[model samples]
Target: MLRRTFSLLAAASVLALTACGSGSPSSTGGTAQGGAAGGGDLTKVSVGVIPIVDCAPVYLGNKLGFFKDEGLQLDIQTATGGAAIVPGVVSGSFDFAFSNLISVMVARDKGLDLKFVANGASTTGEKGKDVGGVVVPAGSPIKSAKDLAGKTVSVNNLSNIGDTSIKSAIEKDGGDPSSVKFVEVAFPDAPAAIANKQVDAAWILEPFMSKALADGGTVVSWNFVDVSPKLDIAGYFTKADTIMNKPELTQKFTRAMNKSLEYAQAHPQEVRDIVGTYTKIDEAARSKMTLTHWTVTFDKDAFKTLGDAAAKYGTLSKAPNAGDLLP
Candidate 1:
């Protein structure tokens, strides 16, 4: 299966502008613990999310009335990258946000008080499955990871899983990892770029991964599995203050989200049915895409392995303790 933690490296630069923006929850003032099955004053919250297949649970929860069942109204905000979303969450415009562990750790390393509320996505650990892949034009001379040397690869972001995973895959195959060049292209735009030979290979995720393959993009490697066998890639997170000031709201939200996650894992077709509603991928494409492993708990050891890899690749200055990072 494919595992991805790609980045739009420039997002870090946009954090300043995002931090200054403020937004309030849509509805307020019921009780300290309001009418939700749990007890919380706040029943409305805005969530920051990217339009990707990984966000199935959030969309599923909203559409199936899971959030409403728990007495919460979810206001969904779509953004291109986490850089824009993270600041919104930090500034209170978003009560919670979906983000990759790398971006969250980068923010935490810079002193953002964040906590994982639920696990959003993980890899299937099936080596050649539909998780993530580095694809080239059909019948290209590039046959293995070693052939990637001195070639340009397209990733959704820089200094992220796209680059790190690709590099690891290349090195494992005896290629000069440092010789590879990486460029940033949005996931939707990557297939066209690769087909046109703009980049030698494109780091692609599901739904799109299936589309790229249909478009004659040849799979060169699965970058993520080579990085680690089982990985917890991304999750939903909120500020510590949200947890402290609105304990019941947080609990209710978590419960609803956990229920949605369980539903997503158990019902892939149902999850795929709603992916297009929240994202650009259509029903046809959604039917072809591979779903991610969903969970509510962030496994401590899995995160540490990812963190250590990030530090080794210079994504982080030092490896962070998983316990200190999680709530």
Candidate 2:
């Protein structure tokens, strides 16, 4: 099971520009506190989605009519860039989005108003919560972690999980983490790049990594969690004002999302089948992957973990301690 956070690391490439299906709620329906049992005319909302395994809930919710049940017509757009969700959600082109926590936390530095109301997942299962991996070509003889020096390592984003994961690996093995070069590459591109020897090794995540190995890419060290056990991950706000003013909507969205998440928790194979429809990966690739569990409540401990890591790494501009992020 793969537990992916945000970044183009999780989705398509053109999400830098976003679109939504925003309109007033359908005249025939309205969603209330009783669960989506009797919603009338629906409000069409543009929600951002990326084509990754983690977003199975969003896709599944659509298939299951969870949004419509709640009088929401979710128009999901797959994202393409790391920092684009901020502009898109704030601009109102997207009513809500399934994006990583970094994009929003990074915005706090710029003084944007937003909030993360739910916890997505922590890596679990034998897949072991490891979401990223550093791999080399097969039979390349690059045995030790030190051999990564002077070699270009590709990541889906800069200073993100892919990079941080590798950073921890480098330091643990007596390698100068900063000395190794990191190139910004997407999840799918990593396979071809590494196969063609475009880069010595790449920090990548599922399906694609599965593909690279199938094509004979050697595994140098695929254990990304062993590299860094940081909260370098999470989903961000649907809208700043929604979190601030329409708290009900925020909670409603969370509830609906958890409904889908609950279904996913009980049905893993169904999740792969659902996510497979959206991702480029095939059945074999999907079957080989591990997954993370989805939960609804946003525990303070997790946010604290994220704040501490950000402060330690200077990822936050104001050095927001855990208190700043808590409600």
Candidate 3:
């Protein structure tokens, strides 16, 4: 069921990007100007985002006229994962994109010149009740992060936030972090993988996490919270050239996105409702799933801790310079 939903979302994302046309933004840094509800010409811009609950704010903000108020019309394209979204932004197929901080850091480490414009999601800092967690089967002997040593774990992406954070959590728990093996498994497919005993543990996020727990999966560690209470997981980012060449456009987007983040943080039910419009998560799972902490402020200290952990785990070549990365 989960695989089917992701397939549909991936197909829609491809079609949306194709329809928008790559590298079609005008000289003024917008695709085209169209009359908005506020009786003004709005610069239409494309934003690449994932189809997860993390991206609910962008959809809610658009519905609430936040983007229109900023003299912008958003062409929100959905990607199945951040990997696809990054390339779209770099190639100008998307004016901006949402991604986890680790992925953004890895891009900068590789000299991609990306800068975060607005915060996306953060850990709730509540162990055993965070937005995401590493889970083991109900009867499994693995009881804590330390037990995960030498066990195969599933993550949505390798060398990104999942494995890096889990390694940090394990090391903090007195486990041999280097001994833990990681395998790539999409979020939707993770529950089944755990149920089938294909993996000893799996790091999963909202909607899917709820499903895993329902299927008798036990949370061994809330990796994000275990890493750092102030950790900012993901945010909206764009190429550095976008900021330089189109300062006005960049500022407008940042302001609108900040407003969206603030709004989503304040209105929880609205965030749940909006998730259904973009993804296949039903109302039951939506209400039960843990929501991520949405904020406009990026936590530099938390980022430093995460980056240092990433570098130590070899996910990054070196600790990322938060001062240069965060706008």
Candidate 4:
């Protein structure tokens, strides 16, 4: 019933970004206009998103008409997973997207002409926060990552942050991460697999991590830092070409984002309600939620951390002068 109510409210509240995007091809909104083919008169912009609480600000902005006030009609496309959204956004299928910082840097290093314009959030607290615990069904006795050699481990996305985290957790405990078989599952569906014993362990994000815990699953361990200690978590990005070609539009977009982020920090509960509108989780569970930190502030450390990760993972063919990519 809450989902139904929230859905109806979401439908009524979200003002499409298309309704306010610049109608003129020449009215560069804020930044320097790029030299590519002129973006035609169209207020509607498709934004790519993944299903997670970090994206709550966008949801709140939609619910509160923030984008509309900024003259952008956003047509949000919830991605099935993080892997696809980066390419989709770069290819123009989406104007901007919420994606893992590592993927964006890897894509940028690969010459995708990407731009990191905003920060979604970072893992906070002394224990670190981006990576989540590795879970096993209640009392399975697979007490450590090392014990799971040759066992199957499921992650929300294959070879992404979840995989990276799982690898870290395994190696920390004297386990050979490569020996384990990795599987992919979405955030919302992981708990059922645990209940049915579909896999030995599930490496997941928070909130979902909370759900796995709530279900009586045993959590082995997790490392919450940026894949590297000083790394950034999630961020919003766009094609470099897009920013170069449409500076004004990009600025307006950033402005709206800044407002929404500030509001998110001020009202976490409202943000959760906005998140619940999309996730199928019940209201009671949603109310007990803890979302990660969100920031619109973009900086060099974030890029360097991402660049370093790419270099370490061989995602970069050659050492990149990370500063070359920053604003």
Which candidate tops TM-score? 3
TM, every model: 0.85, 0.78, 0.91, 0.75
Model 4 residue-pair collision total: 17
- What are the per-model numbers of colliding residue pairs? 7, 18, 0, 17
- lDDT of prediction 4: 0.64
Instruction: Kindly report which residue pairs in candidate 3 clash with one another.
Output: none
lDDT of 4 at 304: 63
RMSD of each: 4.6, 5.6, 4.6, 9.0
Taken over the whole model, the C-alpha lDDT of each candidate is: 0.77, 0.61, 0.85, 0.64
Residue 275 displacement (Å), model 3: 0.4
lDDT of 2 by residue, 160-264 (tens): 545654565566677776678888888888989988899889877776777777788766654344433433355635545667766666666767777887777
Q: Write one digit per residue (lDDT tens) for candidate 1, span 48-122.
A: 888788888889888888988877777777776666777667656567888888878877776778888878888
Residue 157 accuracy (lDDT) in model 3: 80
Best by the lDDT measure? 3
Write model 3 residue lDDT over 1-327, tens digit each, in one string: 012012334543554457344344333365455646445567888888888888989999999989888888888876666566666666676788899998788877767788999999999988977999999988999999999999999998888899999999999999999999899898999999999999999999988998999999999989999999989999999989989999999999999999999999999999999999988889998999999999899989999999999899887889999987899
Query: Candidate 1, after superposition: displacement of residue 242 in Å?
Result: 2.4
After the best TM-score superposition of candidate 1, give how far the Cα of residue 149 lies from its true spot, in angstroms.
2.7
**What ordering of candidates by lDDT runs from best to worst?**
3, 1, 4, 2
Worst 10 residues of 3 by lDDT: 1-10
Which of the predicted structures, 1 or 2, would earn the higher lDDT when compared with the native?
Answer: 1
TM-score of predicted structure 2: 0.78
